[model samples]
Target: MLRIPTLCALLTLTPLASALELKPLALYQSGYPEGTEIVSVQVSSMRVIVSNSAQGQVDILQLDPAKGLNRIARHSLVAEGMGEITSAIFHPSDDLFAVCIRNSDGLKNGRVEFRAAADGKLLNTVEIGIWPDSLAFSPKGDFVVVANEGEGYVRDGEGFRSDEGSISLIDLRAGVAAAKHSLITLPDLAGVEGATQAEHKRLVERMIDGEELKIPFGTSPEHIEPEYVTFSPDGTRAYVSLQENNAIAVVDVLQGKLDKVFGLGTVRHAADILDDGQYAPTAELFALREPDALAVSADGRYLISADEGDTDPKIAKTKAGLPSGGGRTVSVFDAVSGQLLGDTGSQLDDMAAQAGVYPDARSPNKGSEPEGVVSFDAFGKRLAVATLERADALALIDLDQPAQLKVVQVVGAGEGAGSGKLAPEGLAHVEHNGRHFLVTGLEKSGNVALFELLK
Candidate 1:
């Protein structure tokens, strides 16, 4: 028989400690369109804002967390227009946000639209280069940088034809479109070798429409290759993920030049070597290998990168690409110094492999990729990741122990145990009216899931 006093103390401690553990309070189905791919989430005083790109429209949904997942407002874009909305972000202070809309029709150039956060009213539109995939604001919030996917086309009877890719810099303060930077052009072996009258006509048309342009950096820039971009907390440094090149380029924003280029998989530099070895010890340059998304912690202590693994078939593929493997993980880094801080989410792949589970081979689950990472409550103690594939689960990471960041909770779409479909794409935490919320976008389902974080 246990003593009453001892048992009471144990009960009190157990319940109190359990209550302190971080967990999802509720999960609501967004009821968005089937093809709707939810891209990003931002929380504000008036509403819980979500961005979705599907059916050739950018749909914004406002939520009442207290009332549950009901849409307070909605916005749509026409199919024939610049309909593919790839990324959206809110301004730090104002109720204004920007969306990068990709031109899927191929007739017009890509566009960046600034809208009022309250009702989704379009305020201004800026025409960017082809297939703009991602956008990021400088630390000072004075300018917007875009990663234009650059020319989308296919083969013709004579030979292969593609559009020119480029990046655009838009000055918000100037209230005008800035200069456009063209992607470096590479010598086309097939086009040059198989030159024909039709091929020449296609090239001339491309030249007329700003195709086959030079990047000024290098040759043969792949289509829409610059997939994602992120800025340091101070906005002094900018990092762009060159997906096709398997590299991340560090750019000096003030100088407007590439400072260093580091490969994702190889060790390129000595850790302690620098201009002055006595001070400013240089970090060892290590490769990230298939980096997809970038996130900086709220405190600006760490930089987090999501590695989606590799997809190229001709290259050396890991077991992750195999039918029995799910292959997804997140890499952490020291934000100030750019030092690799190890990786997390290996358990997902290990569990899948051990269970003989594999993602659909043909679909090549882009949704399965770990697309975004965010710190919970802005304390940098807890981290959340959206696993687009593996059934769209949100992983809660414990960052207290810097050496061993572990997943504490895995939240799915429905109330019941793993009852709903979640293809979470992007994540954002916002505070309004003194309350905080966690928001995520689903790519495959085109819905955004909002949850009230338990303190």
Candidate 2:
């Protein structure tokens, strides 16, 4: 069973003449057992769906921005030979959602399941290979594209290695996985020079586990390494973030081929730069780091990529790498032109250093690392972002005036007040009747916080 909490205080939000009025809708926490982690959230007109990776279940909660929060329904999925739920999203116009679950034992085989949004009823399931990270639906809602994280373990001459990663194209209309593409191939690394044979071998070995793992023929020249996938408003173009390669790959949707790759900047060794210059090297890591969470504006004019700092031991083992610094930061880009549009929110180091919470430069919780960005308002004026490491806060970015962005108004999840103590993970705008509200999933506390957006 799921639990819903009542809001003790409801503040009437006044709208700014140009901005929309925002208010606190009800907030509800998931009913999973203690220690269960809520990984992501998706909101539909009638319900808000929360998924727990640790519990291996997806809970459906009734949302009433005007009345308060309520858990109308809940359901647990059969393990389906996968480990946990990594990502999920509701179908644009239906009560169905798609989720990607990776294998628990760290094998390459994963699964994608389609379920009824209202009751959490299992509708269909498909087995996939490797760790699938993100899922995006095609414009017509006919296809779903998955970004596989690939294999994690490698054999150093003793045991069986795990190298599984690739992207699978599932035909929703046909209810089957139509095509699978390996992202570790060289073509995926086009325009990337200095990629050595050892790196290629490492990438290949990291994608599939055994000697039987061979590159597929007729695979498009596009390199894999895809982390998060998003589509344009009209679904005409698909933008994929290639975290390992430090670039975003734009794909020609209809043709299903890589059109271009946008690199963030130069990479360098960590020890060479001074403290003042340390941020430069760190900033390079942001550009080159794995882009984890991705969002497209409602109008499809902009694409935002949230880079989760270096978590890989292998990458961190490099002398140039510093312990993943400051919380995370976001990069906004022109979806069409592929141009960079500055960053949103503060970096982990800046947040930690500013808060005086951690005196050491190598402190772990590195204050305020921003993680995910979901969507902009219907007018394309405001953006809602999630800060995973930075307590509970949703960053609102003003698009009409780019210079005015990053001026955030922290709401709900009272980090200072002590009412709530969870980091915000996923965010989305939910509309009831004609009013707009912001919904955020608190990963640490296993709950969802609702806030009204003021104009």
Q: Pick the candidate with the highest lDDT.
A: 2
- Per-residue lDDT for 1-455 in model 2, tens only? 11111222111111123444334556675764322223333434556666777676777666675566577666677465547787777676677777888877664577788888777777878776577777777756776777776645544475434443455666566543343332322254544532111122222223335443333211123224567777787776777766655556676665556576665532222211122312222333322344556778777877776655433332333334332222245666678776666664443333223222212222222223456667766444656455444434555445554433453443434343112256666666666566666666777677777776665
The list of candidate 1 runs beyond 4 A from truth reads 1-32, 39-46, 79-82, 105-108, 118-120, 156-166, 175-219, 266-288, 314-327, 350-368, 376-384, 400-403, 415-421, 431-436
Model 1 Cα lDDT, one tens digit per residue, 1-455: 10112444323322112122234544444465454443444443444445556554554455565665556556664455447777777665576678888876553578888887667787888887777788887756666777776646555564555565555666565542343332322222222211111111111113323455322112244332566777777776667665544455566666555565444442222122122212111333222245667777666677666666433331122133222111255666676556666565343332222222213231222213566666544343445454434435565555555556554444553332122344566666656575556666655555566655554
User: RMSD in angstroms, candidate 1?
Assistant: 12.4
Whole-model Cα lDDT per candidate?
Answer: 0.51, 0.54
User: In candidate 1, residue 343 scores what lDDT?
Assistant: 64
* Native-to-model Cα distance after best TM-score fit, residue 229 in candidate 1, in Å: 2.5
